[model samples]
Target: MEISEIQHLAALARIRLTDEEAGAFAAECDSILAYVAQVKEISTGGSAAPSAGAHKNVLREDVETTEPEAYAEALLAAAPDRDGRYLRVKKILGETP
Candidate 1:
């Protein structure tokens, strides 16, 4: 990696690097690229398969239940403050009607 390349990368990443930092990064980048090049030189026999039992989706079926009254009752019961049949939460958005 060259200093110019490092500067270009820093600019693309929107980062500001000192001259010393850029030189250090250039050396580090060179080392990383060398390692990647070495990894590419490795040869695999082109056989890829699952070693253990096959994977299966463990998710439960989606079943929409209509129980608004029960859900509203549970929600109201959990509220710290409430009016006769509605929750009385603190005013969060500007002035209320």
Candidate 2:
């Protein structure tokens, strides 16, 4: 990576870097890219480490249950806001309400 390339990348990432930092990062990025290129040259179409076996799925069967009314009421009482039986939480997306 050149200093200009590093400066461009820093700008795109919204990071502020001094001239010294940009120079240092340019060298580091160049070294990393060279190492990656070397690794790519040596890699074959097989895993470097041995695999134990094929992957297994261990999910349990889903079950449905209903809580008692008193239990549900206790939970609602601990919330910051609520509307009847539903919890009223702030919207995470779109414009604020």
Candidate 3:
């Protein structure tokens, strides 16, 4: 990816990357892309299935009515700021509420 391409992507993503940062990130992205291209060049000599013998997701029924800790953590993580169980996001309305 070129520096200009990086800038265009940053604009589309609503992110602000400095000129130097954009150039550096573009080089890094290009390196990663090249690595993926190399992987694509490799031949899949023998493959019965795409993900053969891969671990199957043996899902079980919802046996218990309990929430996972990660679920609460994820919600709190999304808050701009948080205290206890409260999501301290920016106020959306005026005192009229």
Candidate 4:
């Protein structure tokens, strides 16, 4: 990477850099790009890559293990405020009439 390119990038990112900093960043960017090129070469030239179907989503069957509303009484009892079997919470989004 050139120092000019680094300076342009810094300008785009709303950053101010000295000439010394730009030169340092240019060297660092060149090193990173070289490393990425090497990785791309290795990935493309080698057969060590996994096959298309090598990965699959492993999920268990979604099924209920307990009866519905089994803990309703316990949950309502723990509520700070309740209307019979239902919990009463403060209205948060709308204006009051």
Point out where model 3 deviates above 4 Å.
8-15, 45-49, 63-80, 91-97
Query: What is the lDDT of every predicted structure here?
Result: 0.84, 0.84, 0.85, 0.86
Candidates' TM-scores? 0.42, 0.41, 0.51, 0.41
Best by lDDT: 4
* Candidates by lDDT, descending order: 4, 3, 2, 1
Q: How many pairs of residues in model 1 come into backbone collision? A: 0
Any residue pairs clashing in model 3, and if so which? none
Residue clash pairs of candidate 4: none
How many residue pairs clash in model 4?
Answer: 0
lDDT of 4 at 3: 86
- Looking at model 2, the pairs that clash are none
Q: Model 1, residue 65: what's the lDDT?
A: 71
**Residue 87's lDDT in candidate 1:** 82
Off by over 4 Å in 1: 44-97
Q: Cα deviation in Å at residue 36, candidate 1? A: 2.0
**Rank list by TM-score:** 3, 1, 2, 4
Instruction: Find the number of clashing residue pairs for candidate 2.
Output: 0
- For model 4, the superposed segments whose C-alpha errors exceed 4 Å read 42-97
Give me the overall lDDT of model 4.
Answer: 0.86
